[model samples]
Target: MLLPFHRQQLLRITLVPLTLLLASVAIAQSAPSVIGTRAVLTTWSDPIEALGTLSADESVTLSATVTEIVADINFRDGEQVEEGQLLIRLEDGEEQAQLRASQALREERRNASNRASQLQERNLAARADVEDSQSRLRQADADIQAIEAQLANYQIKAPFSGRVGFRNISIGALVTPGMELVTLDKLDVMQLDFSVPEMYLGRLTPGLTLNTTTAAYFDEVFSGEIATLGTRIDPITRSVSVRAELDNADGRLRPGMLMEVTIQQRVRDTIVIPEAAIEPSGDRHFVMLIKQSDETTRLAQQEVEIGERRQGDVEIVEGLAAGDLVVFHGLQLARDGLAVRLIGIADDETDIRALLEADR
Candidate 1:
């Protein structure tokens, strides 16, 4: 047996180790629980966004075709016009008089030809005389047709149905050929022109749906579909031009309006988890994975490769699989190989997205 002093020292050392072990057990039992969620296989898409401009489906600037004095202005400024609608009439007095005179002469020549044919049938006129009268009749008809064509040139008609802009010419104004009269635009369907990086050329195709927003209508979102793609990529910017068509039946969208566009390609299936589960350390990412033992659940430190992040979920590109449980809350309280209590599972019914949105 040892002396009293040696026995006291041995007892002290033995109690210290036993007390420490009991304290560790108490801490383990009282460890805070965390919410976890299983990594799920879901569809995700990569969205492409760019700035674009809105244009009319069709546009044209109406102009005068001949140098003449404007005699009549039928349409008001900024009015809707129908195709073939007479818009302006120039000074056609001289042309009208010439047409009328030619028409009267044509009628006279036709009567002469008829009379000559009758006389020839009766052998009362020479064949040469009949032929000469018929030739003069044909010439008179051609002159009438030429004069009528010239008269039509004095009138300006709408070539298509569209909204007309402000007119530049007024009645009595002398206008020359190619002089601006007004602008016409078909606004039933609008075109959105934008550019994307050349790398996405393979994915660009007709009929892809897209959404757009404009400053003029901030709360409204317009929908469209890809209508055309440029033949060649722009060498200087390394981008490809794309055009999308949007229905504007309400006439809310106008030409030359600036807009923001977003195009989504296709959905891809991948493993996803709540972003709260990630424990970033330096350049690497970690997660507290929940592992079930024979009678208890424990935490295991897992390193993962991160991919695209959207909403409140992050994609696990590697080092994780579907159905794997991961701790999303109380990550600070977790330790490697330590036992833990699971309070809840973050799943479809958990409203995790609402929580994330509230946090934001």
Candidate 2:
């Protein structure tokens, strides 16, 4: 048999190993598995969204200036017209006859003036006679010009190149001054009008890019740049009006269509993290950051100031740096100073919505 001291030494050695084994088992059970992602420097923007209305770059309601019977309609409904193209012809037979008569009179007076000048040069007529003849010829020419000016009023023409809307009146209809005939719209480009809260007035400026969407074309995104801004702000609404211009080569956007406008006012390169990584409590936000110590990963609770939250990402304005790893999944299992096992580093191309759904 062994001595009692030897037996005691053997028991102590076996118990020490058992104690270490128990300690390791406890650590493994306490540590939580989490998915983490590194904070990256990315361009982040503060987007301003508002309702807007689309308008033609140039629009006008064509109208008649005088009451007269429409003799002929030169253009079809919804026709594209060029500038100065004839649109309507009113009854001008009387005016044409008068113009012809005046022209004939002018020609006759010019012949008489020439004869009188020749007689004066041959010493057969007085200077006063020649002067009188020349005056009559000038008066006839003036009458012809006056008749032509009146004739021009009876015809209607396009003022600019644009697509014409449907005509309200047909041929032989009497149109009065200021009567609506059609609407002409320059649709090669579009104007978007919107109002933003006066709080963003300082950020308003020309050349700011805007993205717009409409209910009619839900899949299409139209882009434009700020063309103008209203000079005054509405005190009651505390808003300012803004206008942007978009190219509509496809003629998809129409006037008076409601559009959803989005303006990216400020963009900056900043530390960005997944929105799931942030834990909000009361008025403060905290993130569980993964810190490595003694060859083991642990959670470090960090308070961060967030600037903007956009789509699945949050801008970290303070208390975070690029390349820092943060826990994006299993937040409930994470505690400050507790050990953690990194199950995986989230793929940068992974859809945030998918991750959220998985978490759910």
In candidate 2, which residue pairs get closer than 3 Å at backbone N, Cα or C atoms, i.e. clash? none
TM-score of each: 0.77, 0.87
Q: Where in model 2 is the C-alpha error above 4 Å?
A: 1-3, 279-285, 292-295, 343-360
What are the lDDT scores of the predictions, listed in order? 0.89, 0.90
Best prediction by TM-score:
2
Tens-place lDDT digits, model 2, residues 38-90: 99998878888999998999999988777889998888877889999988888
Query: Each prediction's Cα RMSD?
Result: 5.8, 3.2
User: How well does candidate 1 match the true structure in TM-score terms?
Assistant: 0.77
Cα displacement (Å) at residue 358, model 2: 10
Q: State model 2's lDDT.
A: 0.90
RMSD of 2: 3.2
**Model 2 Cα displacement at 276 (Å)?**
3.9
